[model samples]
Target chain A: MSNIIRFIIKYNLVFFFLLFEVFSFYLLISYNQHHKETFLKSSGNVTASLLQLSSGFTDYFSLKEANEELSRENAYLRTLLPDNKIDKEIDDIYSIMEDSVEYIYRPAKIINNSVNRLHNYITLNKGERDGINRGDGVISARGVVGVVRYTSQNYSTVLSLLNTQLKISAKLKESNFFGTLEWNGKSYQHAILSEIPAHATVSTGDAVVSSGYSTIFPEGILIGTIQDYELISGEGFYNIRVKLSVDFKNLTYVEAVKKINKKEQLNLENRTLND
Target chain B: MISSLGKYIVNFIIIILAQVLILNNIDFGIYINPFLYLLIILSLPVNISNWLLFTTGFITGLIIDAFTNSIGLHASATVFLCFTRPYILKYFAPRDGYEPGSLPVPSHFGNAWFFKYILIGITAHHFFLFFTEAFTFTDFTTTLSKIVASTIVTSLIIMIAQMFGKRNKRR
Candidate 1:
């Protein structure tokens, strides 16, 4: 018994290291599929609220720039509102349908942002209490910014467009051709829009906008313009570089978009896939 | 000197909090996350048992892992560092040998020796971390660049931390 005890004591360090490694390996395997610890995944409600309070104190200096952007967007919308002749023709036909579509915007400030990382996430001031929820779309006046991932009472985290996990459906403004926009984590100023078929007439400065296939964002929200592109040799897809509309480094304010029928649409899709 | 038990507990909490709250947020255009927590392992007393050093390192890293969503990356890297630390220290041991009950801080070893010790240990830690995080040599060039950038930044931060400790001691 004494010999066994001495042997265990002598080799305890190796035993402990192996034990820890085995435990860590188990966690790594589990975390690879899906993170299990929800508590540590994000800051909880209390911490998020504290962050929101802190952001309010810090955001005062940027009010002028935010106001300027808002007024400019207001003026642009006003100009379009007066020229309703084209919209009136479309409304006449759409009036026959029962459901009318409209969108509401919830203004929020960006509390923190990181663009250079492969998996960047942004935090915004608005949260569940302010009508933000997981899967809601967020955008700045410049373009689409990201989608809401987790929300607390007073703050929400966004999976930024620059995150490798994010893939948004975008298309050329002048053509039906579309592709998935993904960040390569190389630069904040550029991203790659892949899977664009070679047959599409893509150019250096073509406009890209949301496809509106998902309820998170409305159709025609400006995403970016292609900066450069190349057709991969022997492949049918084009790797298009896009200049993002939102300057991630200087982003201050954003608007959260809530789609009224998103839950219903998602449920229907899930059921169809199950069949 | 603070008891080893108390020091270990305090260092464990400090490193985990600092890594998660502060260093993890520093993007710096590259993946240059300073794992300053390894300083705890590097600064263990010279007379301490090797087994204790290894245990402390593993625990410190496991706490870090629990916070960052990166499962065992920190744990494995830290364990590797603890394993290599004794060899590195022995290679750099003074001709007269280490002073008894002496800690590994700059005050005991002087700035140059302390700096070298930290640099070697942190390099090993970062190398293991990045390679494991990448888990592939597919982007070998990119991984190599990240390893270099992160090492430079981490070494600078560790030196700055040492300087801060020295300045505080004078105060």
Candidate 2:
């Protein structure tokens, strides 16, 4: 027993090293789950605030670019408004008659962003205090950005569309043929659109937009344009490469979409299915 | 001893800031990522015990991981490097071994010895980090490219930093 104790004591450092390594591996495996829960991600208060502080310093350098994007978004939003009194009357009537859930857009700044990882996440300055919640859809002025995965009091973590685990329901604008949009983990500006029927006419530069099958995003939000595509022999689906519209590397501002009546709609759907 | 402790703490904060703010945002193409934060582990005193070395490595890595959302990848890689550090030092040591209270900076150790030491340490670190991040060998070529490119880039940056840092050597 004395000899065994001596042996163990002599190699205690090795044992401690192994223990710490095992603990790290445990964290890696548990946290890298397929669905990768957002509990321990970058939205933690300290890290989030640190990121925001750094961004505050860096945002100054990009003032010109940011101003351009904001004005462009302003011009687009102006076009979306009713330009005539007749259209305004019709829009008011349409909104009142349509007793449906509406998705409200809340603007937020992206404090930290990454595009060079298998699972890229973006940190936004808006959080629970700004009414940003988990599952809110985030988009840029040009197109889709990501989904809000975690939130603290003043910040939120968005699981970017570039992540491998994210799949968005998308459809072609020309044929309305729908498929799933996925990131190939190679390039930040491109994603893969799969499951479109091989027989569907897919040409280069074809527009792909959200199908609204998932309540997270509204219908017809632009995702990308088809860069190229190939149909594998005897396969039912076309393998398509799409050039994403949103420039993720240059993303500074985004809007978190909050659906006001989603819960009620889901409950109603569930009740009808039960009957 | 108290001054040395304060220096290490300050070094820790500086390295973490450089890493999380500037280095993390660097896009040297898709394959290259420069992790200059490993300098924290490399510059520690030669006489520190094995367990303290490992703990410091873990703490440094945990900070980077928390900021980058990489979870345990950095921590595991840094710990592995720490566990292997002593053996590497032993193999490269001169006849009398490393001088006490001396840092592993190139100014004290000479260019050739420092190059070999840091290359090995950084290579081990980048290899473990990229492989763990991929978590699979299915994309063997892609992972290999990343490991090689990043290792070279990180080693070059560390060498440059060491060259400039030679001026600050304490007698």
Candidate 3:
């Protein structure tokens, strides 16, 4: 009818605004709901390839720092094994056990990363083609970084530990009293370690590391050093502040961890839980 | 010089690149995130079509989201900015109002008006963006601090950007 046309013409701008808002909100909610189903497909290949192009230029500036980090990690690894005593024997043992190694590390460059957002994510240059897959743990030379959330054929995204949604299983290295580590959306330097029993002996400067209870990370990867702690009387838990080790600001290189028998481990856990 | 439309298109590309490549990599730490990309939206002509403005806002946000890997977060916030922009213009409009087809920039509107414009617009945009990214008002103080600090940083950057490229109105 002409009346309807007139109505539309009179309020078309408002109608257009509403329409766009609804459409975009749908894109937003659908993304949050179907993250595993469609996120990579929606912004997957094309975006990552472009980010790779840009990171190519930026990666040069951080090479020295990355090299220093790699060498530091190498030095720590060296101290783990004294040089002259048993190098050849250990090498032979490593090769023999390679087939059944529990965790495999694949080096990848970070093509895109952000820390300012509440729910931050990092994108790496490696993906399914490189044997990286969803739910795999990612770590920098310094410490645990995040877990792979989605993967394209040649690119993948990590849900950075800085993200509010991610909860890393961490324990105090001193007493091995474990808790869940979470970001408070406050700063990149710190995260909150909750679920620690109030009675645990925690102190400032105590070290925190991955508990390995979550099969994603191997036992004893350093997460950070604790900065502070306080007891919540009613909750009967201590809120410990951890100073993260990995400098997300200059994060450029990382390794994706693939558990060789993760499938079997997860299935066993699920089967037990189902009962 | 190219036409104003061409200029806007060029600005659209440059601002996005600067945001994703340069500004994003600057590592201003947790407090100061400068969003100069809003320059493209804020500089849109006063009397442009509503539908076009909204679509442009959405597309700009979607592009940023694509690079950053948060598919709809920026798009949602930018759309909200576009929807409220006209009313913001009205609230801070000159008494006689904006000349038709004239772009909103400091050179055209004077520094005071333009600064106020950027202040209001960037505050709303950053608040919507940071909160939605947070997805909850539970930790209101930290989120508010981020919004406040980021808005200040973004406003100054935008104002500094406007200080350059003075328009030669007499010519």
The window of 10 residues in a row where model 2 chain B has the poorest summed lDDT is B162-171
What are the runs in model 1 whose C-alpha is more than 4 Å off?
A1-8, A22-32, A35-37, A45-104, B1-27, B35-37, B47-83, B95-100, B167-171
lDDT of 2 by residue, A89-174 (tens): 33543253224325656778898888888878999888999778988999877999999988888889888998987899999998
For model 1, the docking class works out as: acceptable
Q: Single out the weakest 10-residue window by summed lDDT for candidate 3 chain B.
A: B162-171
Off by over 4 Å in 2: A1-4, A34-40, A61-101, A265-275
How large is the i-RMS for each model, in angstroms? 3.5, 1.5, 2.3
Which candidate model has the greater TM-score, 2 or 3?
A: 2
Q: For candidate 1 chain A, which ten residues in a row score worst on lDDT?
A: A78-87
Model 3 pairs whose backbones collide: none
What TM-score should be assigned to candidate 1? 0.79
State each candidate's clash count. Answer: 0, 0, 0
Q: Which candidate comes out best when scored by TM-score? A: 2
Model 3 per-residue lDDT tens digits across residues B10-110: 77887888887888877777877888889889888888898899889989988887776677788888888887888899998888987776778876778
Candidate 3 chain A, run of 10 with poorest lDDT: A78-87
Residue A183 of model 2, lDDT score: 95
Q: What's the residue-level lDDT of A167 in candidate 3?
A: 95
Winning candidate number (DockQ): 2
Residue B44 in candidate 2, Cα distance off native in Å: 1.7
